[model samples]
Target: MYRDNLYRMEVPSTMPAHAFAPRNLNWNVEQGEAQDLAHGLEKSEAQALVFVSHARPDDERTKALFGFLRRASEVADVMIEKKQQSSWDAIIEALTPTLPLTSSRVLEAKMLAQAMTKVIESEDFARAADIAEIGHFSSKNPSSQPNRWKNSGLIFAIPYKGVDLYPLYALELQNGAKPLPIMEKILGVLQEKDDWQKAFWFASPNSYLKSKAPKDLLKSKPQDVLRAAETEAAGVQHG
Candidate 1:
């Protein structure tokens, strides 16, 4: 019961992969569920099963979570349920297999960007459009945002502490677009949250102009990031 004293609120907007205070789900925590949880816990099975959380990266809860999972993975074959917190005990038991340590919060985002070779801003779609895609299209041929922005996708949320949170960004596409398993693709992109320029470089290197990063962007200023976005927008050509 690591409940913090401060009040928490959810960001109000349409985010593809929304992160919020962890909301506990009520279920039997029955034997079947435990087995299922254990099965899904196998990290080696998937490239990575990232946990997108709202917990401050430096929070004690983050450390606790990592420690907890590492311990669990070590004893994955054993039924050492008593050591786990009641809430997570159920999740661990329900896991289907041995899992890898999850990359949480921004770390998850950064790793996902590396895996997918793309980036996600974690902003609402509209904000993403504001900072990333610039310019307009003809009404007869209005441009559509990537599919992930238009819909939600495969994602998992773990308790950052007492709160429920998830990845901020959903996925869209690569520069050299190829279809991904819809859910994995979503998971892949969600992993890329908040590293838009790097994502672009990785996913579709050809889409970016490497010659001159806006000075402000190189300095990691917000306005400069927007400048880079506009530059990207102006450069997009529908062939």
Candidate 2:
């Protein structure tokens, strides 16, 4: 006696004739429909649903999308914060100490100093110091240190909210409270210009100096730096 065995097929048919063809997704048609629906929507209804998408935080696409959406929303108070200092602002800040003593100059110098401190901290060039510390380092009386450095042209005694701050890199400790020789020469070259212009010249990188910043090169290559400064000063004179 033989028993007939029966089993239900679990697998789907693999025959091409039995397969269903995939329908092509028409993105253009769907997008048009979405636009139509959005257009037909009331302002309140549209505002009720915000379709937000995000890209990488630093991506240009994300920034563009954010700008487009921000403009589309007619947002007047939305502020886009700048993460890096502009070249012009950096120059102005560097020159702040050179301006005539004034209340506004003090405030600007303070803000600029704070900004520069952040940058210098990152670069590890030199630590920024308040008047007292700079005075201690230079072995001068704390109260009159700013005046001493300013008179000697050793440092820019940047006035900040009724106080003075100095960038430590400006002075050469190895040589008895002396200003960097190059700085003195550069200052002489820049004597005719306003503090802002002089500051810009010192801080900005020069192609002639192989893109080295004048302030940074003051110690190692004073002569070459001084020549570059003279060239710049001449250009300013002739122009």
Name the candidate that leads on lDDT.
Answer: 2
lDDT per residue (tens digit) for residues 1-239 in model 1: 33222211112233335222232322111111223344444432323323333455457775576556555544542343333346576776888687666657668778755654322232222332331333232333322333333334342232323432222222223332212234333334334343343334323423233554332132234343344445554454321
Which window of 10 residues has the lowest lDDT sum in candidate 2? 3-12
- Candidate 2 residue lDDT tens string, 1-239: 22221111111223234222332221111111233345444332212223333333445664575556545443321221121235446777988876476898899999877665554443323223343463355434454655665677755544434555454555676544545656766777777875435555566789879998777777788888889978987998999
Q: What is the C-alpha RMSD of each candidate to the true structure, in Å?
A: 25.4, 23.5
lDDT (Cα atoms) of all candidates against the true structure: 0.36, 0.52
Q: For candidate 1, give the lDDT of residue 214.
A: 32
Count: clashes, candidate 1 = 33
Please give the lDDT score at residue 49 for candidate 1: 28
Model 1 residue 62 lDDT score: 59
lDDT, model 2: 0.52
